[model samples]
Target: MHPPAHGADTPLFIVLNAASGRRDTDAVRTAIESACNAAGRRCRIFLVDGPGKLQPFAREAVERARAGGGVVVAAGGDGTINAVAQATLGSGCAFGVLPQGTFNYFSRTHGIPAETEAALQVLLTEPPRAVQVGLVNDKVFLVNASLGLYARLLEERETFKRDYGRSRITALGAAVVTMLRGGHRSWRLRLAWRGQERDLRTRSLFVGNNALQLHQVGIADADAPEEGQLAAIAVKPGRWWSLPGLLVQGALGRLGHADDILSFPFASMTVKPAASGQRRIKVATDGELNWLAMPLLFRVAPEPLWLIKPAVAPELEAARE
Candidate 1:
């Protein structure tokens, strides 16, 4: 493999989100500082104390990375990682992750360790490798992006997490509660992809850019993301009730076998919400909700994440999974 973009001597600009994950900020900060000091590597920790500060801090970290040939590292959940990645995507600087998220799918999928010490070791020593990214309009998503019912579900999921605490069980419970509450809204969507245009109705749309997630969810063509493409799953119109069943199948790792589910792989797609004068819509990218302009264009990002991670064969990913 090519030599790692940065060496052990490169400085690190870590953007730490105090709100992400369940870890104690003071403890994590101390660990980061101790590790960097021991390695004799320059490390700067930019604390993101609020949502409003994430983008600004990330931009500042990117500037630092550019100035010192340092690596910009995100030290938080997927949302925090997404924020940092938005700034680093095309900045010609390498990016790193210190996964402290409940899922940490992006980091675990790349073989980054969960322990703070191990993660810092990789950040300080590993080479940079390309990882696929998905885009919804201008927003960058590392794992997945969604809209309609799924987007609303994410909003509800956050509320549930705050009350019930963060866990896989809590997430599943949120899904069950959201479904049982019965707010399924269908939309007439015009989808144009691969030079073909088709109209369809669906209650939710999810686009996945992480092959590891697609595979874990039992979506066929799970390798699409690794092949410079994206995989999408849509809830068929009038079949919103089937979502619960699909969710169960997903938990069982057999979601692709279900009927009334629409799944496909595409390099690019244009989705027009067939509503009159509705240009703004809510989208959830990597679990962060935002109001994005309509005619959502889902495509593979022009650039890849320069992730500092370990190399492993695809079949060996079972351990990481």
Candidate 2:
């Protein structure tokens, strides 16, 4: 393996989101400080109040790193990490994550520990490796992006969390309630994949950048994030009663066997309204929702981002071979 691009002299800039998840900010900050101190790494932590400040703070960190060649660590959930990672793109700054999210899918996919201290240790000592990033329109996502039903589910999940509380159980409940409430809606989509164009009606379209999630959900058997491809799954419109069976298949890692689920790999694709004159569509990238102009362009970024991973990451081992 190549030596890490940054060394002891390279300062560590941690951009933390104070409102991420339900973790106590003071406790997380203390843990980060303790871990960095124990690792003998010189670090500076910047805490932001909300998403509004995350991007600006991350951009500043990137500028600092570009001047001196350092690591910029995002110390929050996937949203926080996505903001920082997007800023670090093309800047040649090593991106690190201190997982403080409910899923931490991005961090876990790269073999970073969920615990603050252990993840810090990896951030302080490990080398940054190149990892593929997924792009929808102009936004970059480290995990997955989707349209239709999955997007609605994410939106409902957030609403549930805001009104009730955040937890895995609550998320599951939200999914169930969302489905029961007849939230799944079919889209007449014109999809261009692998140079082939097709018109299809589907309830959900998921493009996964994190191979681990694809495998875990049984959408794909191979975890090949470094292979320069995105794993995509589309669900055919079906009766509401069929949703549970599909869910079961996913949970059992057999989603590929389900008739309604279509799985494929693609370097890029175009998704837009099949009907004429429709100029906008809603997309959820890494659980953040937005309405983008029609004919959404999704692609694997031309250049991979340099992401910090644990020295002993199993994913890294797999990538090496």
lDDT (Cα, tens digit) per residue for candidate 1, span 1-321: 232358878999999999888899999999999999999999999998876899999999999999999899999999999999999988888899999889888887788888898888888777998888889997999999998888998999999999999888899899988877776888788899999988889888899887778888788878888789999898886555667887898888788887767899999999996666878889999999999988899999877778888886343267225
Flag regions of model 1 displaced more than 4 Å: 1-5, 313-316, 319-321
- lDDT: which candidate is best? 1
- lDDT, candidate 2, 25-68, per-residue tens: 99999998887777687788889986588888999988888876
- Model 2: residues with Cα > 4 Å off, grouped in runs: 1-4, 311-321
Q: Lowest summed-lDDT stretch of 10 residues in model 2?
A: 312-321
- For candidate 1, report its TM-score: 0.95
